[model samples]
Target: MNAQFDIRSDSTQISFEASDNAQLSRLLDEIARNEALPAPAPENVFVGDGDYRAIGLEYLGHFVHIGGLKPTHRVLDIGCGIGRMAVPLTQFLDPKTGTYEGVDPVNEGIEWCVQNIASAHPNFRFCRLDVAHELYNPGGTMAGDQVALPFAGNSFDFIAMVSVATHLPAKEITAYAREVMRLLAPGGRLFLTAFLVDAEDLSRPTARPRFIKGEEDGTWIADPAAPLGAIGFDNGVVQDILKRSGLDIQRVSFGHWRGIGSTHYQDIIIAVKPE
Candidate 1:
């Protein structure tokens, strides 16, 4: 099944066209001067260990140069923890046109973003879902696959799920892909990051997390006792899921996590919904 799809091993430097380069530069300058931008979330409230400001800036560049994000495009950010991605966009997205909607299972992060980020930028909104996750929200009422995201169909121009898939089981991943397909407007783009592994990558000694256990459904995990702690899917499994969800695979940039020389830490998959 994977042989049918063209997944590129991209190792090129991150560069934007002249116009985009200029736009990114302008946005960066604005972000630097904007003293009103919310301060970084406190250590306890921040979800991930990565430097909050640096990762946000880095991925903001990726959204522009790789995801083709425009100032006027509506964006949906899944697993938006403590507004790491939203803080940078407050300077770039047009107040009248571009709007951002972020949803996550962790209540603390969502609350922080609502009070700090959304209070200042009215167009930016955050919602906490009661979705259950073994590592993040174990006592929630809803299963990850069962939650119907609160949004209209074909609503967003750009959707991103950074570091979200790496923590989900296979079924939830499929459910989220289907929802992403439904939420994205026709011709809209999906920028997703995941820990994708092929058989050869599994044999490499330097592959981060080093998935040692295999599930019956072909998903791989770093720890069998805590499957959702760090999950990986076979390259084919991800391709099949996206294809089944009616998304056209545009590109796949392998990440440095697997000892590969790439720009990102997790593999990036860019796809589009056909018009």
Candidate 2:
């Protein structure tokens, strides 16, 4: 568990590979430089300063431009890594009647977000949830951040997982589904993406693509029908979990189903809590 940084504690031990050593060092320096020197104040962390912020900013633009969110809509983003998505989205919220809540397991990510999220958006709220899971853990199971979040039932109008649940195995995914439903108000919508193969498809997959060879391998190449422990997924399995969680199927769109298998597929979906 030795990367380069001495980041470890009684409760947890996390480390990056030597490959990431330089990146981590650079991040520390960047924070120090920005913090000490202080630039002229746009203070818009997502766009104002760092390279990583652009990743978050692009997602924010898509959520509004593609996802069709109104500035006044209450938005809750799960697995909101850093302030990339959260920082900019916070700006769109009316902050008085509208609410924007973002959660992530990383302490530093949340700290950066808290310190930089605009003051203009008074209603913007972001919190660290140890119960948050790593976006992509081994076997594609989601890891819960170290702490549980505090929220009452049926509290949100809309919630999104983006690529969050895509990495979760069955149990965690089911657990998260229940939590999301519990937090969603009546008629609220949830947008999530996953690698499930559905019975709705009377036809099997048309093809399966080979794993990207060597260093070029990408997550988009994941084969959902691979195997039990493989990072892939299946619809039959997912549907059972959804039923147990009391969620009815709504709509699903498929992506990444190339290659040569009947089970290779990915989907972005929208679902609602039962009335």
Candidate 3:
């Protein structure tokens, strides 16, 4: 199948496109024949580490129990790679009351979800945006900072962007943060994961850390030329951005990226729009 679609722009300059997930469609049909057999291989599920399935399932639990996502809520999943969260969410979301909207600049991932998940669950929809990121969509036409989301204001009750901010520069991150805030309804919750630099790490200024914990500064860029190669922000900066985006920090679970005990490698933050 030719992997391309028509790109449309709206009054707000939001670009939109939806691909026919031909590859995933075939895979899903094949899996349906053998219900007991394990689903498609990990690579087919998503392009990530072997533990992606476990991580995805854990995220589902956190969103529902900790972030207060409910069956009746509308969800907007930014950077929805494949169907990691969407797969588990299929079992949790009420078909009649819940609706899921996932958008990603990577067409392949969105196509997969459109075929494997959206085909069976009409309430779930996948969209493609042309937001450019050096790591993910270098050839994309739209700049990440300038691309307004296709959705209207106050559209979602729950918004999740796992590991999305880690690859974005401060300007781009701020742009996306504000967009998330715009899409969220009053009292809506947001779950975001990113690499956070601590004051202690900044003070020490490790020439080279054991892991990718980042430099002594609160924000670290692995490659100055390629901002998205790997970026880390200080705790203060992260909080200030969230506050300016109209979100109040409900919980912040620092990650072990800095050698601290953590449930996930990347720091997890749960914030909510003011009621």
Candidate 4:
């Protein structure tokens, strides 16, 4: 391969165009081969292989349909555990103009993505943040609220954080919202999934209160014994945080976590930076 075509070795950091049928065929074949391979061990990945594929495809479709993800978009996947979303996106995003960058706290998931997804798809990359979460990374040094991501300001066109916010405390959620706003290119969109709780929703007789109130009124925790087991926040407070961060809410779709019989299990929020 010539200098212009040399993207396989450090493909995790590079992007290339599949300008011809042969190149396109090769790309498709690589994706198919990867899809056939078994996912990382379930214990390490936190989700079953079959479930990963199903949820990944579902999230990808939602990103396309609801978030307006385009072939040319530069995407950032927060909490990209074990390449769940990255697997399906390999076939959707165009190699020439599209890119995927995934960041996660767990080393196992990041390692798997770097070895498999990033190696095969040059336009896709993964990074491990080593962020400290009592449940996920007990030994981590960095805190999600304080750590800055490796990306430049105003860079990504689309950002997705599926189930990520559900695991973050209120302060971390605010910090991430601010960081995401800073990293979003003008007009860029963000898609996030969480267990949203409004005042009325919380008051409902059927409400099970997955997360009990933490020290902060805005924060909630699933396990009082383990504060980081699962986290949630007041939906109104989160919405206010995003608005304060300069992101306009484009859509809000509640999910079945509230027993409302929605398409997904978590509520989805789509926010966009102003053009």
Candidate 5:
């Protein structure tokens, strides 16, 4: 399915849009034909870690069962690395009604997704955001706070940021929270994961990936030299940010990162914009 799509950009943001319905039909047919293909080997995984296809499948269930994702919802995938979540979603979302927009700072991931995932699913589009991070995009020209995402206000019915906040500082998290609130439609849901620590957890001696640095601003880093490498925020700070962003916190499921038997490695937060 060689569908043509438009890539648009302005000073602050860049976007991809699919304009061909016939291309979508062909893509869906191709997907149906290859539904039984085996998952990729772990050695071939590049963007993050673990088996790429398995991780994507795992998160797809999380999105549907925990985040209330619908087949027809318009989704905004923040930090969509190499189409991990998008790949599994193609099987679930309705081609005619559901749409996906992914944004990430990593150029390679975005480029790979455009070539691999977007070509197979026209409704799935990817964009690169040139935002700076200590680990991911050091050469990025813009700070996370300064970025104005290209999408219109209240555009997406669901917004996801899996494993994203764990790498961002307090200021960037706040900025992204506001952006999520702005981009989400009224009553839309926001699903994200982060490393969360409470005062009691901090005092414990056996805390996993002990965050011993930068507790002044409710943000802690496992490594002081590389603050963005692995970060944990105080639970209260996360609550405050979402509340200030005008999102109502619905649930926060603590993950196994702190040595508890949870469903994931990072805390899952579900919030909804008020109607």
Candidate 6:
């Protein structure tokens, strides 16, 4: 019963059970053992508030610094849950030259990260802010709401938001886009993912409902089609919002889970601040 993370860059977020690959499973188990990560926590069935969010976050973190992180760069992990990106990031960071910050709306997520991992490390910081890549906890924050960031502008060098925009509505996406601009440092990079498409090709819709009516504010929420959250992105509208926020789109890539099919492909976006 080890808690480890086994992730390779080429691997996508596809279902592991379906593959039935013994070697991959053993690889994952080995990685888990090294990290002391608990046994596979039934990520396929994300239930309740503490679904396998941590698992996804961990995997995303694995991808964030996939190739490698520079020695002096700082990292901001938005929607950072548990110690997914937060914990693994420590390995890549230089400790003195590098800094790490994580934000999460769920207090428990932030609390767990801070207590179990961040607090003990002086160079590392964590807050309960929910803002993504925004200037909330410039010194390693982990709290932010739908709107409003507490950090000064251009506070981070590198920020990664793993599947944060996947569950947001248009307005929410707009908010995240604006915040991303404010939080990124000049020449900084922001890596994130979305479940929706911005380009209206008549093939893709803005949203396909996924929640029971009145689930929260009687709002028609996106159907929880995916295990983690909602899916789909607005048609380039998010990129436009970033323009107004003074941010520019650097690159966009489409990714598909192993067996999830085209409908669930993630829109990988990399936005950069003006150098």
Number of the predicted model whose TM-score against the real structure is largest: 1
**Over all chains combined, what TM-score does candidate 5 have?**
0.82
Rank candidates by TM-score, best first: 1, 5, 4, 3, 6, 2
lDDT of 6 by residue, 25-117 (tens): 444444444544322234422212333434544453334334123435677777775665655444435556667777666566666667766
True-structure RMSD for candidate 4: 6.7
Q: What number of clashing residue pairs does each candidate have, in the order they appear?
A: 0, 22, 1, 0, 0, 33
lDDT of 4 by residue, 1-275 (tens): 41123222223322334343354345444544454544666666674235666677677667866787766789999889889888878776877778999998888888899998888788999999888887778799888789678889999999998878777777788888998999999999999987777656655655544556777777777678866656677777777778988999999988776656677777889999999
Write one digit per residue (lDDT tens) for candidate 5, span 107-176. 8888878887788788989999999887889899999777678899999999999988888877788899
Could you tell me every candidate's TM-score relative to the true structure? 0.88, 0.59, 0.78, 0.82, 0.82, 0.63
Q: What lDDT score is found at residue 169 in candidate 2? A: 56
Candidate 3 local lDDT, 67-147, one digit each (tens): 766667799999888877777566455577778999898888888788777887888899999888777888999888886
Number of the candidate with higher lDDT, 1 or 4: 1
Whichever of 4 and 5 has more lDDT, that candidate is 5
Candidate 5 stretches with Cα past 4 Å from truth are: 1-47, 202-207
Tell me which of candidates 3 and 5 scores higher on lDDT: 5
For model 2, residues 1-275, the per-residue Cα lDDT tens digits are: 53242222223333323345354344333333343221223443322234554444444444443344444567788776555666445434444556878886656566666665634345767876666333322332234522234678888877877666555556666777778777877777776766554333324455333322112222222444432222335555555566576766666656555332322134556677788
Give lDDT for model 1.
0.81
Candidate 2 ranges with C-alpha deviation above 4 Å: 1-68, 118-120, 132-148, 197-230, 256-266
lDDT by residue for model 1 (42-147), tens: 6655456777766787898888778877777899999997888988877667676789999998888888889888887888999988899988899999988876
The 10-residue segment with the lowest total lDDT in model 1: 1-10
Greater-TM-score candidate between 3 and 5? 5
Best by lDDT: 1
Which window of 10 residues has the lowest lDDT sum in candidate 2? Answer: 212-221
Candidate 1 vs 6: which has more lDDT:
1
> Model 4: runs farther than 4 Å from truth?
1-38, 47-50, 199-209
